[model samples]
Target: MWEKGYQTPIYLFNKLIGLQAVVEVVSNHTSNALELLAKQHSQMKTFVYQNQLALDYLLSECCIEIDDYKKTIRRLAAKIKKVAHVPLSKGCR
Candidate 1:
């Protein structure tokens, strides 16, 4: 499913940093995906700047279409929980 390997995790950490102007969530999301994003946070910041308008538009459009918000949150939370515990034996340490 992940085509880029680890070079670009969630591809949104830097965007998030740009979105909220905060570095706090970096600590919250240290899993594989988030870890990848965190590694290039400096560049992510720049990427966000270059695409803020489009990013904002995309996020806004996405949020507007979620009819079952609670279910979506639960599903996302479950997925995040699962990903957080990925066993080291699956690949690299």
Candidate 2:
């Protein structure tokens, strides 16, 4: 899960760097400069949105895991409370 989750950010970083290189090369005088720029802009927008969606999905999964863990802790807390008059020790006392 960790590996998959980090893939999106890595992919986005590489794409941005690659596109920036392309933009720099095309910075010189050219008749289709505007057209090329427009295309790149659209492509960049798509890439950004796709990466965002992937990240969002990963975050949602992480949230679900967090909620699950919270529930488990709550359940354990309830069990501990039932078994003892005082709460669990704060440290290894």
Candidate 3:
């Protein structure tokens, strides 16, 4: 879930970078449009950096959650196994 949620923005940022590259290629032929595309490209680059930071943070959090969940499952399994191995003594119902 976390991956899906964060991947969209990262993907979009990559597309933006691609688009900026294409714009830059065209900007080489037009002096007037170069300045505008440059500004937008700069802002997009900043957003890409920020998005990367956010994705890193989200990945760390997801890792922590997965680790904790694995630990809990192991603990529960051990407890269940121990109970299953215990002898049933003769006692009053």
Q: Among these predicted structures, which one has the highest lDDT? A: 3
For residues 1-93, write the lDDT of model 2, one tens digit per residue: 557655687687767666755554444323244445545656676677777678879786422111123344444544544443332246613
lDDT of each: 0.47, 0.51, 0.52
Could you arrange the candidates by lDDT from highest to lowest? 3, 2, 1
**Pairwise TM-score winner, candidates 1 and 2:** 2
Which stretches of model 1 miss by more than 4 angstroms?
Answer: 1-68, 88-93
lDDT value, residue 34 of candidate 1 = 47
Candidate 1: minimum summed lDDT over ten consecutive residues — where?
A: 61-70
Using TM-score as the yardstick, the better of models 1 and 3 is: 3
Candidate 2 regions exceeding 4 Å error are: 1-31, 61-93
lDDT of 1 by residue, 12-37 (tens): 55464454433333323634344454
lDDT of 3 by residue, 1-93 (tens): 557655787687767666755665454444334444555656676677677678878786422111123344444545544443433247511
